[model samples]
Structure formats: C-alpha cells, structure tokens
Target: MSPAVSPPDARLPHRDARRDAVVDELRRLMARVEGVPKGREGALSFGLSALDQHLPQGGLAFGTVHEISTASEADLPAAFGFLLALLARTPGSAPLLLVLASKKLARCGLPHGAGLAALGLAPSRLTLVETENAAEALWATEEAVRARAPAAVASAIGGKLDLKASQRLHYAAREAGVPLLLLRPGETESVATAATRWRIGAAPGAQDRFGLLAGWRWHANLERCRNGEPRAWMLEFDHATHRFSLAAAVADPSLARGGEAPSLRRTG
Candidate 1:
C-alpha cells in the first residue's frame, strides 16, 4: 500500500511544543503523500472519474478544511450547488457526517439525499447532527472528526463564525483527516483558519419558455492555503450529471451577482 502519510502514531495535543511539531510533521508528510496537491495546480474534482483526469491528484484533500460562503441569496444557489457536487464526490461507502447549523433551513438535505445518490452515501448512511448555536455545532464537529469513519464532514452555518471555534474545528479536522466544508452567509467575514476558503456564485443555465434556469458557479478566492495560490475561476456545476465542470472567467449572468438578491427554488 502507499505509505501512510499520518502515522496514526502521534497522539493528540502533543504536549504543547510537540503540538506545532506534530502539525509540522503532518504538513511534511502531506507534501510527500497527499492525494490533493496544494493550490490550483490540481482541478479539485469531487471523485468523478471524468472530472478527476483534469484535476491534480484526481480529488480534493480527503480530510482538509475548505471554507465556503456566499454574499447573498443571489449567490446562495452557486454555493449550495457547488456543495452538492462536492458531496456527490465525497459520499464514499463509508458513513458520512454532516453537521447542520441551520436545521430549520432544511436545505441541508440536498446533498444528504438527492444529490449524492451515486457517491455511496445514501440519506440513511448520512449522520446529521443538528444544533441551534455555533459553539454547540463546533463541539459536535470535533467529535465527528475524531470518528474519522465519515469520508467527509460539512456544516451549513449562516453568519460569521467565532475565530476560536474555527481554530478548534480546524485542529479537530486535522486529527481526523476528514475534509470539511462550511457554508456561511455573505455579510459574515471572519478570517478563516481553514486550509482554504472559497466563494461561490450562480450562473445562468439553459432556459426554455420557463424562467431562466440557473446553474451553480464557484470561485476560489482562497483566504489561506498550504499549497500554491492561483487566480479564481467561476466553476460551473451541471446538475444533470452531478458534475463540477470548469468554465472560463467570473462572468455568469444567470445568477444576479449581487449578494442580496434571492435565487432558488423553495426546495427547503
């Protein structure tokens, strides 16, 4: 087998000094053994074979944290749509963990069921922990990361996240090695401690006599990364095939680019 990147040898919290040492060592090993290369050098496909070919390492870092948010309802479609494709790629046969900070929103299930049907995590296989508060949700996220059985863990939370809570979640996710996706509102702009932070927008899809059909679009204005940084691309998510195909520059008119505009079917 490929050599193990994380030894499973190091213990948690690593006696203070050892903590940074351990994180450093983990980064060193990740450089050598990682499935996802740092930065835009890789395409960041969600595990679709057709999708993987163009991307570096064929998929994203299995357990790293990737932050996501939209500026307004106008942008929510793209953000949520990108997430669906992401979840579609991540739902390996292993149980998946999804912690919903907006249980009342109910949009959490798009990926939980209909979207990721092909990824091996049926709705039944998904374990969702619902909470009303950020602090409480962060606690459960830590537990999920420790479990490590889930192929991925995601949280759809609105508004700014507490810096300390973000850091705690980062370390927990680091130990478990489960990739994380957090959904935040547009107005909220707390600097993320995650491996990478991204923004998503909506794209106008094909339309008939009906109103314009819009697809989800994504951009990578990475706030932080261990790898290289590249200019952002507004990606297109094709719902029919559950694929995240790339598009050119950042101009898609289907989605009103403004953060305050609303654009979504009331599936929630």
Candidate 2:
C-alpha cells in the first residue's frame, strides 16, 4: 500500500496555523526589542505644548538617538540650524559634543560661532570633534555618548550609514542615559533605531522693511517617531528664548504690512 499523503486542501489549515504562530512570535520579539519607556522622567520638551503632546512621553525622549536630516541638499543648512536649536534645548548645562566628518565640513562649511550663539547654544559650551570620514565620525559620536560627559551629542556624517551602526549608537545612548543627535545630510533612510527622525527644509523667514531675513525658519517633518504618528510643521526658532514656535504665529513685520502668512495645515 502507498504511504498516506495529506491532500493540499488538508495541509492548508496546518500551514495557516504555523503562519499565525510565526507572526505572534515576531510581534513578541519586536515588543521586547522596542521596550516602552517607563515614564516621562527623561522627556525633553519642545516648549510648544502642542508639539510636546505629539512626541512620545510628552516630549523628545532622552537616552536615545534622534536623527535629523534634510529634505534635500539645499536644506542642509536649515537642518543643521535645527540641530543646534535642539542642542540648546537639551536639559543640562554639560558641554555638547559635536562630531563632524572632514568631508562634510568641507562641503557644508564649518559651524559658525555666531550662528551657534544665535541658537542659544554658547560656542564655548560645545566641543568639536573632526573626523576623517563618516565611520570615524560615528565612532567618535558613539564614544562621546558612552562617556556620558556631554549634555548631548551630535554628529554630522554624510555617507553610507547602515542599520547596525545606527543600532549600536542607539544602544550606547540608552546605556549612558544620553541623547545622540545624528545629522544625516541628503536624508537617507538607512538609520533604523533612532527614537525619532526629522526631515527639515528651509522656510521663508520673517523679513524686515528692507527684506532682510530675521530668525531662522524651517518646514519640519517628523518622519519617524516611536509611539507617535508622523507630522509636519512650519517652525521658527526664537534665538533669545532658544524655543520653537509655529511660523504663522511668530510676529512677522511682513504680515503686519499686509503680507499673506503661510497656511498652518496638517501635513505628513
């Protein structure tokens, strides 16, 4: 007699059951890896109540890496400016470590002392680390984060960044209870473990009677955020306050002079 064989239709139930088991196991593993925060103790507020509400734990979480990138090459300056603003918002007075690749600096130019001061980050409180390449820059950033010396760490490394590298940095930040800010110019998607990812573009700034731009403005997109949905906002930086506010709400001389303001629309 021929060995008994299950018919294709009969095998369907077993296959379906196995698939469900695999899916359930995968979900459990993901949950274990992406552990939820216990509380809001490490949260860093954006100072905007509405923005804070959109972030996980009522604000940007510390002890994790937050990636910042530009919407395009042209927006690199805007993204860097935004990163400085965030550094100014870090909760402590410890010196900030800023790691930059030589190539990136050569291409984008160096961070200006005046600009840093304008963002409320005193140039004296920042430590600069120049690396030969992206890998070196990442290594320096990881070291700074692990040391737990800086109030916050930031790196501007433009080149290939893999998921594993990003995860390593994330783990270091978490272990040291420090926040790592990664500036990925040109906006690549290789970074996987960041607590949040922001994509920025230059927004029309408030102008004076002579058409000179005032405070920095950017169209920011929260592309990826854990525990929160993606959102976009036109934000303007208040140099004196080291805070962010809606661009439409900022007092614009042009607006007072009958210039139409940008619409505040919810975008992706």
Candidate 3:
C-alpha cells in the first residue's frame, strides 16, 4: 500500500500554520511602525526630555505645521513665548517671517523687541508682515513657507481655520521643508490639518534663585498629535539660557496649608 503515503504528513499543516502566523505578526508590526508620524528626518529636538520623547521622531518635526492657541487673552504672551522658545531651539540662523492679522495686532499690540531679545531672538532676525485680515495673513504665511527664505514662518489669526485653508498651509509647509507656527485665539478651536496642536496657558510664575518672581512659566497642553499621546507639562523659559526646563509639580494648596486651596487659573 506504499506505506499508506506516510499519512499525508500531518505535521506539515501545523508547520505551515505556524509560518503564516509569524508572517501575519510581522505585517502587523510593520503597519504600526508606518502609522507613526515620522515628521521630517533630522527633526529639531525640543531639548526637554519630557516633551521631546513624546513628539514624533523624538522632537518637533520640521516641514510640518504646528498650532498654538491661548486659553485667554492673558495667556497670549505665554503662547507667543512658547513659539519663540521652539524657534530658538531650531538649528539655523535663517531669519523668521512673522505674519499677523491687522485685527489681531490691533488687539494684542505688537511683540516687544526687548521681550523677543530676552528670549534669544534678535530683533534684526525677525521680519513682521501685517495683513488686512486672517485670509491675507494665511496667504502671506503660505507664501513665506513656500519661499523657504526664512527658517520658520509664524502666523497669528483671530478666527477658526477651515480644513481647506489648513490643508493648503500644511502642504505648502511640507513642500518648502519649513516649519510653520500658527497662533489662534483661545475660543477659535476647530478642526485643522496641523501636525500638532498645543493649548498654552499661563502657569505659576517661576521664582528666581532668591525665590522672587523670575521668568514666565506656561502650561503647555499637547492637545493633538499625529502619533503621540496627549500630555501636559509645566515649562519654564529661561531668558538667560533661551531654553525650556520642566518645572516642579505644584502641591495642592489645601494639602500643604490645611485650608481651602488657592484658586488655580483655568487652562484650556
């Protein structure tokens, strides 16, 4: 009977099943890796361990657009300062182009040269462009990013950005291989194509070595990230160093003082 054909090699089916399982697992692993937003290769590091590790490519991705919005009018400076801090961390001497809507400028006033200098940004290195409205501001921003003349392009808009406009800016920034920073009002939150969305609010002010008021501190909420989890941290900007440092967590006032807690500022 030809030795019963060796029972059709029953173990062969089990071996084939195991091989298929291994192949399936490999495919799944590859899909997960590809799903991560790698940003641009050679991305700039934020220099803060807490923040950089959570960002795609282990840092802020160049050639992508990022959004920063304030929690209130009071938080505007913090948001602007945060953006400047990020720009300072970038590895280039190329000038930065700042586009502001006329309405926003009229309301928030112009950024002080001395304040920017304190943040390590030279006044001469900045070029300000005022536009009649948000639309024009966005257009100018796109042009600036497309030109790739500046190391970065930043725009301040007072209204919501539709998906179409956001997509246009995103594409332009990617094509030019430049970073784009968008500052929107606190209440203007809406869907957009930004690679990352940050909501910044004023945190407790930092104290000097003598325990006196020092530089500004901000609570940056990573509200949206393409391939990162949402996380929040208290960041202190050192004017002298032009670097951001993680702030120590604050203790609950009630727990520390055995009384009602001091009211904390609301942060979006």
Query: Tens digit of lDDT per residue, candidate 3, span 121-223?
Result: 8888889998888888888999999997998888888777888998889888777778888888664665477778888898778887899876678877777
lDDT of 1: 0.57
> After superposing candidate 1, which stretches have Cα over 4 Å from the reference?
1-44, 47-59, 103-112, 115-121, 206-224, 248-268
Q: Local distance difference test, per candidate?
A: 0.57, 0.76, 0.73
Which candidate number would show the highest lDDT if scored against the true structure? 2
Query: Model 2: runs farther than 4 Å from truth?
Result: 1-33, 36-40, 208-212, 249-268
How well does candidate 2 score on lDDT at residue 243?
78
lDDT per residue as tens, model 1, 1-268: 2444665645433554666577556755665564333342232355445334322234555556677776456676567656656765664477767777764245533344554554223677678788888677777777788787777788877656778778777766666667777777464575466555566665555333576544445553333444533224446655556555555343343342432323222111
lDDT of 2: 0.76
C-alpha positional error of residue 70 in candidate 3 after TM-score superposition, expressed in Å:
1.1
In model 3, the Cα lDDT at residue 42 comes to: 49
Q: lDDT (0-100) at residue 110 of candidate 1?
A: 38
TM-score of 3: 0.77
TM agreement with the true structure for every prediction:
0.63, 0.77, 0.77
Higher-lDDT candidate of 1 and 3 = 3
Q: After superposition, how far is residue 206 of candidate 2 from its true place, in Å?
A: 1.6
Query: Where does candidate 3 clash, by residue pair?
Result: none
What's the true lDDT of residue 167 in model 2? 80
| Each prediction's RMSD to truth | 13.1, 11.7, 10.1
